[model samples]
Target: MAYSEKVIEHYTNPRNVGSFAKGEDNVGTGVVGAPECGDVMKLQLKINPENGVIEDAKFKTFGCGSAIASSSYVTELVKGKHIEEAMTIKNTVIVKELNLPPVKIHCSVLAEDAIKAAITDWKSHQTPASAQEPRKAQES
Candidate 1:
């Protein structure tokens, strides 16, 4: 099977490939694996709590060229996007961008899952806005 130029470009020179600190308050992480192909992907995001925008994104993928490209592409897509916007991203976008064949479509799906999982993990760490307000002193 031949790979598209975009796929080759990303596979050879993938971007945003690294990890944030394990427990940073603003960092969210997602790790997902594909059983059929034995591909594992880890995606992370550093979010700005004030505005819910992703400040940075990073990913590590262990699989074929398509999987790596998909992971690499999604990292770029999510950065600077709101968490809700990131959640709406679908695997089809990755497939189209990388020109992945039908068989490799699952790779894009894995990338999509990674994004949702990371967002979910981030939400888990957040408290309701009302809970953060300072308490006033009671009248004596």
Candidate 2:
């Protein structure tokens, strides 16, 4: 199957392709595998605890170009975004952004899942008191 230009670019020069040390207080990691294609993806984020913003992101994906592109693009999307804001990212956005074809949709889904999983892992590390605190109200 043919790949989109964005996919090609990402596959050739993926962004943030590395890992953070485990057990870092500010780092969260998510690992997921696609049973259908035997593909695996690991995504990690370094978050700013005080403001809940993602300061950096990294990903390693073993799959087709679509999967690599999806992971790469998502890392970029999550950077500089608040945890809550990053959680809203959907697979459709990845599909659109990478011009992923129908069969490659699962790659985008994997990316979305990775984002949520990482966020969940990060939240799990938060102190109960801090986790329980009410979030700042969003201005309309």
lDDT of each: 0.91, 0.92
lDDT of 1: 0.91
Candidate 1 lDDT, 1-140, residue by residue in tens: 99999999999999999998776778888999999999999999999989999999999999999999999999999999999999999999999999999999999999999999999877766767522432221101
Please state the error at residue 133 of candidate 1 in Å.
18
Report the lDDT of model 1 for residue 103: 94
lDDT (Cα) of model 2: 0.92
Candidate 2, 13-112: lDDT as tens digits: 9999999986677888899999999999999999999999999999999998999999999999999999999999999999999999999999999999
Q: Report the poorest 10 consecutive residues by lDDT, candidate 2.
A: 131-140
